[model samples]
Target: MQELEKKEFERLLPYLYKRKERCPTFVFAVLERFIPGFVFADDLNSPKTIFVGTDSGLYFVGGPISNVAFNKHFLKFCSSKLKEGRRFTLFSGSGGWDGLISDCFRLELKQSSRYSFTFHPEEYGVKEVQLQEPFTVSRLDEATIRSSHEFNLEYYERFWGSAGHFLDKGFGYSVIDGETALAGECTSIFRGKVYAEIDIYVDAEYRGMGVAKKAAQAFIDHCLKNEMIPCWDCNVENLASRKLADRLGFREPSSYSIFVKNQ
Candidate 1:
């Protein structure tokens, strides 16, 4: 497999478009150069199979699944990357690709189901949240972003490369107790032409409270005000995330399989 340069990334867009369901937003993030990643294909000029890998995850799109040589090369590449300590969770909408991956890395891969949710405005109406003393909800600013890192805030760095990038092209909301951010909801992946994928995190000390929902509501409202479609995704096993999504107006969940390193 040949690695494609950034300029050649667009060549894979047609393959992405042909798929019936939405590919993960991180796929688009790599193509759009919003973040660092790699793309590989059987042939750059006219390719039938493509792979996109970012810090977030790995994806395979389009193919003649029976291409033994290509499949072998992919396995070797993945093996080498794993040895280098790079973590990857493979995602695809094609059963054929899933089967091929499952067969090749039977011992090393663990299978999991991921659920995607679509936002329904009619189901969600804004509600004011009352925070007890010393807590407040606010938009993420530079100072907030910097301070949040103390709480292990990673969405901005992981998806946007840096705080400057996120502040310029992305947005988020955080629930802070005094100067410490206890919870937040931000765009994990965003494409101006498409949608923003929501990522939420709450500190262990504040899990049961409604802090996450409060932050997510503000984030959702911002997306609506800007006419951006907000998207949600979570592992099928994460019942809490599912419940939160439903309460925030996300519905019609579609399930997909993902393969992650067993470790």
Candidate 2:
């Protein structure tokens, strides 16, 4: 497999579009150069398979499932990267791809299901959330993010590379109680071309207080105003996340598999 440069990244778009399901936003983040990642294909000129790796995870698209040489090369590449201490989780959209990866990896791998949801603005309507005194909803600015001792700050840096980049390319909201951020919802993966996948966190002490819902509503409002499609993804077993997405009018749950190192 050959690593394709950023300019060559677009060549894989046709393959991505061929998939029936929505492509993961992280894949677009890499292709758009919004974040650092690598793209590889079986052939530069006439590719049969494509692979994308990012700090978040790995994705595979395109095929000739029987390409033994490319499969071996892919396995060797993954082994080397894993040995180098990179925690790469393989995301598979179809059972065929899941089976392919399972057969190739000799190491113990754990499997999990992730659910993807699409937002329906009509269903959500224009409801407003009112917070009591001492609690407020605020846009996620650099200052607020920097001052936050919660997950929001680390999320931007880890996923978007830095707060500056996140500010320029993405947006979010947080619910604060007094001087502390109680909950936050932000763009976990965004590609201006289409969707913005949300990521949310609520302080343990503040769970079930509607703080997370408030933050998420504000985030969704921004996405609607900007004409960007809002998307939600979570582990299938995360009932809280699934319920929140449903409450937010995100419908059509689709299941996909992700393989991670057994730990």
Candidate 3:
């Protein structure tokens, strides 16, 4: 497979936009901020298939444009990447990639259900609420990163690599109880300049309170102010998150299937 240059990468916009909800959001953001290092079959001028990788152990396939089948060359390329020791979760529209590898190689595919939710600013009516005792909402920044609870530190480290990266590449708000972070809502995956996937976490002790709700509202407000749209995706089994998305004015999530390689 030939690597696609930036100009060539832009040509996939129509295909990507056509399957917006099906594609991962980070693809959009990474293409905007970083070089995709994307590879495609044929020349960049017109590609029949596209492939890109993610830091989160995912290999994304965009298409087999114009009814073309993914050939042996591309499958070998995928095998080479998989041999690098990263377990891959493949995201492709429909069932095209279902057994493309297993049929030729020893690996297997395990499919799972996923959902995507989009926010509508017009449907969201911000509610003014009183700041009760010990509950405070504040924008997460360098100062807060240093002073926030261990949970927040672990969270930033896990998803963002470092608090510094989060500060530079992400934005969010935290609900604090005095000095402790009770809950937070931040961009887990940023997609282009216009969309971000929301990630929220609340301490187990504080679950029944409206901590997440308040923090998410503040986070959504920040997105709206900057003209960014917020997206929420969760496993179908996570009922609590599904309810939260509904309460936050996110439309019903669109369900999609993802193939995760069995480890």
Quote each prediction's TM-score: 0.83, 0.88, 0.81
Local distance difference test, candidate 1: 0.76
lDDT of 1 at 14: 75
How big is the RMSD of model 1?
Answer: 3.0
lDDT for position 188 in model 3 = 48
Please give the lDDT score at residue 139 for candidate 1: 78
Task: Evaluate residue 231 in candidate 2 and report its C-alpha lDDT on the 0 to 100 scale.
Answer: 85
154 in model 2: Cα distance from truth in Å?
3.9
Predicted candidate 3 versus true structure: per-residue lDDT over 120-158, tens digit per residue:
777788574455777888877777667655436666665
Decreasing lDDT order of the candidates: 1, 2, 3
**Cα deviation of 158, candidate 3, in Å:** 6.2
Count: clashes, candidate 2: 0
- Across 1-263, the per-residue lDDT of candidate 2 in tens digits comes to 78899899888777666667777888877887777788888888877677787765565444655777777777787777667665668777577778877776646667789999989999897467677778888777877777666645676777777788888887778787888655554544556456677878787777887887888888888888888788899999999999989999999999988888877
Q: Which candidate is the best by TM-score?
A: 2
What are the per-model numbers of colliding residue pairs?
0, 0, 2
